[model samples]
Target: MKTSLPIFVRNSMYALRGGFLVRPLLISLALGLAGMILSSAEERFPVVSAWVPDALFPSHADPQVAQVMLSTIASSIMTVVSIVFAILLMTLTLASMQFSPRILVNFVRDHVTQWTLGVFLGTFLYCMAAMPAARSLPQPFAPVATVTGALALALASVMGLIYFIHHISRAVSVNHIVDRIARETERVIDELMPRKRGAVARGEDMEFEPEETEFAVLNVRSGYICFIDTTRLLKLAKAHKLRIRVLRPIGHFAPEGAPLFTVSHKSRLTAELDRDFRSAFGIGPMRTMQQDVEFGVLQIVDIALKAISPAVNDPSTAINCIDQLTSILIRWAERAPPATIFSDPPYVVRVILPWPDFKHLLDTAFEQIRHYSANDVAVSLRLLRAMDDLAATLNDDSMRKEVTLCGRRVVANCATRLDPTNLKRLEDRLASLEARSPSFATRGA
Candidate 1:
């Protein structure tokens, strides 16, 4: 039940990357502090002051010029920062209103956007910190090198602003958003399931016997189960000589006092063990990409759902979502899923956890959209084509069968709502899916 160090570090990193604040703030502060130190050194050390080229600052002796330049740059940069933030907020507002609100998370996590804020604020901080060094007090000192650095930063900020404008423009596009989600989900899949396609050893499923003396450990908090430290769970179970069954999977909601896990050999449980158990499961109000693949899938699904809704009625956007979902599913199908049963020693099972299988993930990725887009012929056709693409990629017969069944469902729903011509198109796509599977082809024949 005790969380391991690795899991704690991973969770901390996930939290750090969740928003746009921590990194940018740190960068700005670091740059600001550096500017103060560098300017101070340049003023105190005449040798360092000698490094400043005469061409850059013709009047290095007169501190007023440097003071005016640094102050103006700082003030102007702050103004630009305000404008940049305003534009960002407006863009996010428009994107949220037009697309899904969930997409705001994606925008917040964008590196370009984060760097944009950081560079702008960093430039402002740099100029401000260097301004005080350009004073005309006891001995007039300009800190020309420091002023030059501030000017360079200002130029970089200008370039960054241009890039930020370009990046934000594309980022607000639905296609870019969906593609970004797919890439992120695929990266998670690669990390979680490192084995290449068809590389996993296929063995007969092992049956687990129920433990005689089992006790349910109640959850202390009510929130979505964002991540479960499976390795830690396995190690804890091994150390205690117990078997553990995780009641709630990642992306599932666990109410307070609900059974979080069931541990065998209940007599061995102690207060420390219970605390460890609770700590191993990271429950939060919102889902993260830590171990929750469904969260990413749902992000895209949310967009598609909103696009095809009665109010939006944008079939093209829904189709784009389907295309991206297809890419995500294909990548997912190609990777071996993480093992559900974690064993400590060779074959000694210590932890039994439920991970979403390919079929369940397929359902999550397409089912809701399928239900919502049943009547939309364009969306329905794209859904079938997506399933067909997935079916073609999967090497397992059962997996192909699942895809075929999902395609059939789309066809069934479309037939119920579409005209003859649209239904024919749907049937043709369904046939393509069935043709990929020998079992489906035999049944059809």
Candidate 2:
């Protein structure tokens, strides 16, 4: 019994699938078959008998009767054909819209020529089938079938001409080129928007908390909502040639000093509500998992770097430290996945300076460390300036986040501000030299 049930269920599923795949094709075939049958009947009867003079079509047997019969057949056939064509065209369009909007848009944009050709072909076919007769004079003994054929030909010609006119009109709109582009862009954006576990759905008001670590704030200035720097955004827009009027979008950090928006506890209106009433709040948090991981790594680097020293080290040691640090930084910087590095704030700059440049900096710093014993205020200040410049280039939250994350991973520092294990690790490595100065001077004297 169990085996039989499973077999039944599988057969039912197969039937459902087959029904969907076969239904439309069957319907179209049925429609075409019906048309062909009617056309065959018309051919056999052949109203307006071949080459018969119009004069022979008796005035007593009203030509209007034959005309009406032929007109009815042609009209019915044309209606069916139009309906079938419309359905097929719409099906193609819908399929493209779902799977390949760009392709669909391009097809629409370039369809003018195709449409024209279709119309012309349709017109030519009707002309050939119509078999228009040339007669010098009318006869009193004209057959009714001759009149019908002539009428059908006239009707077909009219329809063909109309189709041709409609086809040519597409050229004016150029097959709706601009409209197709706009549709394709919207479709792409819809597919690409974040759809994570906590993402906000369409048409919902965003609510944010004051201390939400992943929330975004937006600021509007000069009729533009300045999310990140306008110049950078404008440059990207120009390069990509995008036409989006972004009021606000996901992954963009607000400008500096921007006020974060939140749900209000209360608002003054003409009506009074219960004292316990609460405002609704909702917002999709930014994806910061990668950022957090990177930051943790940077912290590790800071700890390690603080344990190393340059004051008592050989020149080669300094060079090695610099080279190793550069390698570590570059590896972290390049390891960022997807667009996460540019999505949020605290951008960390992670990269190695070029060969000669990195080597030169190391050599220069090593000379100062040996001569001044890591106690040189000028050298410390110089290092501070370089670090500040890097931080400045981060300029915004996105860059800062990435750089800080990379820094934490590759550079290590000690509580004493020196390389705790090596003088280069801590922030106060210079202070160590100061502490040693008195003992050194006494010994020298």
Highest TM-score against the true fold, candidate? 1
In model 1, which runs have C-alpha deviations exceeding 4 angstroms? 1-8, 201-204, 442-445
Can you tell me which runs of candidate 2 are displaced by over 4 Å? 1-39, 45-116, 129-179, 191-445
Candidate 1 residue lDDT tens string, 1-445: 2244656676777777767778899889988998899898986787876877888888989899988898888889889888878878998998998888888888888888888788878888888888888777786788888888888998998899888889888989999999999899888888888887667653226565566677999988899998887777877888898888888788999999899899888888898888887778888888888788889999999999999999999999999988988888888888877655546455566787777888998999999998998888888888888888888778899999999998888888777788999898888778888999888885454
Model 2 C-alpha lDDT per residue in residues 1-445, reported as the tens digit of each score? 4323433354344333333233434433443343334334444665524444657544424434444444455465456556645654675475443323323324433433343333333333332233222122372222344344445544654565466456534522312332343333333223332243224322112222232132222333212111122233333323332211232332234443454231122132112121111010011222111112222222222222332334233333233333333333332222322221111212221111111121232233223332332443333333333333333433234433433332222223222344435444433433322223332223122
Q: lDDT of each model, Cα atoms only?
A: 0.84, 0.33
Query: Against the hidden reference, what TM-scores do the models get?
Result: 0.94, 0.21
C-alpha root-mean-square deviation, each candidate? 2.1, 24.4
Q: Score candidate 2 by TM-score against the native.
A: 0.21
Best by lDDT: 1
